[model samples]
Target: ALLGDAAHPMRPYLAQGAGMAIEDAQALAQCLSVGNAMVPEQLQAYAQARWARNARVQARAIRNGRIFHAQGAVALGRNLSMRLMGERLMDVPWLYAGGSEVHGFNGNAL
Candidate 1:
């Protein structure tokens, strides 16, 4: 399974965490939809697509956490960056616009 941080996860500075996870699941589904047909090649394809993306995320998260925890100037910069993005962040429609792709057990796509 895919994994992210165990503790002190970075905020989605680029608004990617959940989206990335959804994309991962979707991509995995696309890769693994063998239609009752399983084979070594299918598994290999899924691994090929997902592993690189997962590694990129892990690397980015570590870098972001370091930036957030860096010395005074860097920490200040991080905070300032948050403030600069905060307003647009709150209003971004993807944060709330529920859709079918975010499906749930009740058939709610959100």
Candidate 2:
């Protein structure tokens, strides 16, 4: 199965490419460790485990690219929001949590 950039091809705005690749390896490892499943099934399981989180990260990266590259009123708003919220505005709890809720793999949440 495709993994990391091959799978998602995200921009660097979120700085998640390496992290996502590591996560992909972990999920793929977990899938391959399943005793009963065939290789095809394991690969499918890996896809199921990773797809949504990867998609979310990719989308967020795109949004961050726009935000980082904003100009005029958008840039002003972005700066104002940053000033008001500080780093809390950049907090991504779901992502930081390793998306366990979305990854019920090997009888354990990722």
Candidate 3:
């Protein structure tokens, strides 16, 4: 089964390539270790577990890339908004909280 970059190629803006790789490894291992599951079913489980979370990360990374590379008026407005909002603008609760259900292991390690 594919894992890490082979499964999802993420942009560098969010600096999540390595982090996602670790998560992928964990999810894959967890799936594979489950008893009574065939290899194909285990692989499918891994994919299902990671698909949405990886998509969300990829989308956020692309968006951050655009915001980071903004030019002219957009850049100016972005900077002003960031300054006004401060750290609150950078806080992503969904990302940092890291819900286990999305990982599909229910907090158990392989």
Candidate 4:
């Protein structure tokens, strides 16, 4: 590989990424380990929490990747819209925050 322009790797559209994987794995493993000690409702809650959140992220990542690869007006619009939207959207708490499983998906008791 030869050096060229600096590269900023595109964020994985899947969002499960490294951080998500760690969180999901830890949560899943812990939830699973509890076995019969964990109620079915809580188990369902764990799945609901992980799947819903990750699904949303994966969708957005795919969309962003498509936009990044888009041509003409579509590309311009996506970039400009993101610029106008500010960096806060880029620094999403939901994606980067490490403790999502501490309180479950909605942050209330599961």
Report, for all candidates in order, the number of backbone clashes. 1, 0, 0, 1
Weakest ten-residue segment in model 3 by summed lDDT: 99-108
All candidates' TM-scores? 0.48, 0.89, 0.87, 0.58
Question: lDDT per residue, candidate 2, 85-106, as tens digits?
Answer: 9999999988888743323345
Which structure is stronger by TM-score: 3 or 4?
A: 3
- Number of the top candidate by TM-score? 2
Cα lDDT, model 1, residue 60: 65
Candidate 3 clash pair list: none
In model 3, which runs have C-alpha deviations exceeding 4 angstroms? 99-110
lDDT of each model, Cα atoms only? 0.53, 0.85, 0.81, 0.56
lDDT of 4 by residue, 1-110 (tens): 10111111225654446655555656665555554454674565556546656555667777767876899998898789788887655666766665455344345543
User: Model 3 scores what on Cα lDDT?
Assistant: 0.81
**Stretches of candidate 2 exceeding 4 Å from the true structure:** 101-110
**Residue 25's C-alpha lDDT in candidate 2?**
87
Superposition TM-score, candidate 2 onto the true structure: 0.89
**Worst lDDT 10-window in candidate 4:** 1-10
Looking at model 3, residue 96 earns an lDDT score of: 77
